[model samples]
Target: MKLLKIAFKSAANRKTGLILASVSIALSIMLLLVVDTIRKQGKSSFVNTISQTDLVVGARSGPLNLLMYSVFRIGNATNNVSWKSYQEIAAFPETDWTVPLSLGDSHKGFRVLGTNQDYFKYYRFAGGKNLAFAKGKQFDDLYDAVLGSEVAKKLSYKLGDKITLAHGLTSTKFAEHGDKPFRVSGILERTGTPVDQTVHVSLQAIEAIHVDWLSGSPSPIKISAEKAREMKLNPKTITAFMLGLKNRTATFRMQRKINQYRAEPLLAILPGSTLAILWNTLGNFEKILVAIAFLVLLSGLLGMLTTLLSTLNERRREMAILRTVGAHAWHIIALFLLEAFMVVLGGCILGLIASYVVQLVAQPLLVQLYGIHIDIMFPDAEQWAIIGGALLLGLFFSLLPGLIAYRRSLQDGLVLKV
Candidate 1:
């Protein structure tokens, strides 16, 4: 108890120096946690964006490209699958359900998706959770549309509001289907996924809007929106589709069959396996981030070392005073260790508080810019391990100065060294 009291007194007397060392470590610790938290939660939010589907089927292309375009709405498709092929696969004996996706339309920068009611029935997210409506029911009419949460909020749309879609995915307004404006029939609740940024409409609506158009523009011969709705609206082609199998065991067999189909080049990817490959591709980048974090931590520890070592000369008189008062060499060593512990513990706690503040400020921005929602949390077990490791390293490095003070006190007992 006496040793602790003396250590605290000594630390309090030099509070300015100790505080500086603590703040440096605190910032380093905050950076390390932030990097790790972002990497982990970003990967988790991405993988859980779409779930419960066994396979994603698209025209022959790289698996990552297909995943990005179909799931993330990030890229354009290389080719589209014919509706004939979609029907054949949907009818496969092992197929339990299918959701067809028709892309290539936009509304004020949000992608427009053309899908049937099966999308509502089969699509799952965030661990088998179904899509819930925020305002109204799904679109049952040819001229009805369903707005994702972000689309509705950003455009201030509501039920029965008329909106037109542009021909291409870009925001450019060169060719728009203004004559066939659709009324908003539904608004989806926010899921914090890519779905929140989409405009959904029935497959028939896609064909109806394009019936009188050719070569990417309206032809001289045009059909009125009412007249087009009266005609057939079955889609002849689609950008991609998702399938869920009845028997999990037959997933591989069906994937092989789809890839080797004689009708046309097709690709079927298992979402879980494809995601694993994606993580592997990014493994090196993650390692680099972790390495940078460690370097920052090391610099912080070295700062503490430098502060302790440089102050040893000034502390020699205090060590001689302790020896005259019957303090042993081991007690001097113990006092320094206690002081180091206090500094490290204070820094670790301050780092946690700073991390919380940073996350609070940045959480909304991350969601807005990247569509990645960070799960707010206290430090977990692994993080505790990191804190403990930092404290131990600080204590370990402080031993050098402690040993110097101990030997100097022994040699110059009861004497003030000039």
Candidate 2:
């Protein structure tokens, strides 16, 4: 009990130094925890964005490019698959269902996807939940459009609102599809994927909108909207398609068939395999981020050590008095370790609180602007291990000053003075 009281008084006298040490440790914990969380959640978000789809078929190109255009809506497709190919693949015995995607043009910076209603039924995300309509139904007419949750909110659009497509994927007006405006018929629930950032319309509507355009430019011969309705507007090609397999075992067989199809040199890739490849190519960048975080942690620890070592001289008189009162060298060592342990524990708690606060403030912006989902919660198993390691490190470093005190006590005992 006397030893405990003495230790408490010692720490209280050095309250300012302790606070600085705690702050440094807290910052280190914050860097380590948040960096790990971002890495894990980023991978989770990427993997969970698409589910249950066996294959993504697109033109011959880099698998990452295909994924970017088909799944992420980030880039334009180099070439499209013919309608005949789509039909042929859909008719394969191993295939269960297929959703075709025709991408070109944008409405207010959101990519417009032209597909059938099976997209809502066949598509799954983050736990196999099918796409749900937040308001109204799917597109029922050629002029009706379905807005993504983000598109509707960002543009302040509601059912029956009219929006025109741009000639390109941007909102800039160098070339615009102003003549063909579509009415918003529905809004989709937030899925935290590219779906949340897209505008969906029927396949016929895509052809209808591009009828007067040739080679992505406005045609010299213009036709009225009423005349376009009378003309045939069926899409003959599409950017890509998502296939669901009837039997999971036949996935490889179907992929081989598609790749070797005589109609065209099509590429069929398993989403999981492509995703792994994508991560492997990009994994080094994540490692660099983690390394930088570790560097920051090391710097923080050095600061704590410097602060402690520098302040030890000023506390030498206090330590000598405690020794005079019969506190052993080992007791002094335990006191320093306890102080470091307390600071580290408190810093970890504060760091966790700060991480949650940051996530809360950044969640909506990340989803809205970048479509990244961050879950702010208790640390995972890996994070707990990191915290444990940090605590052990704190104790290890704390011993440096404790050892100095033990040596000083031994010398002072022989001289019987400070």
Query: Which candidate tops TM-score?
Result: 2
Residue 65 in candidate 1, Cα distance off native in Å: 1.2
Cα RMSD, each candidate = 3.2, 3.0
Q: Model 2 TM-score?
A: 0.88
Give the alpha carbon lDDT tens digit for every residue of 1-418 in model 2.
6666766777777778777777776777777787788778867878888899999999878788898889888777889999998998899888899999999878877788999999989999885889999999999888889998989998899999998878777666656767778899999998888799889999988888778888877898887777788989877999999999999999889889888988898999888888788877767888887787677666666666776688676766667777888878888888778777776777777777777777778776767565667777788999898778878888888899888977776555433443
CA lDDT, every prediction? 0.88, 0.82
TM-score to native of every candidate shown: 0.86, 0.88
Q: Which portions of model 2 miss their true places by more than 4 Å?
A: 1-21, 361-370, 410-418
Evaluate model 1: give its lDDT: 0.88
Query: Best-fitting candidate, measured by lDDT?
Result: 1
Residues 1-418, model 1: lDDT tens digits: 8889999998998898888888888987887787777778878878888899999999999999998889878788999999999999999999999999999999988889999998988888888889999999999888999998988988899999999998997655567998899999999998878888889999999999999899788888889999997898889999999999999999999999999988989999998788778777876788888888788878877887887888887788899999888888788888888988898888889988888888888776666555667877888888888899999998998899999899998777665668
Task: In model 1, state the lDDT of residue 90.
Answer: 95
Model 2 residue 334 distance off true place after TM-score fit, in angstroms: 3.4
> RMSD (Cα, Å) of candidate 1?
3.2
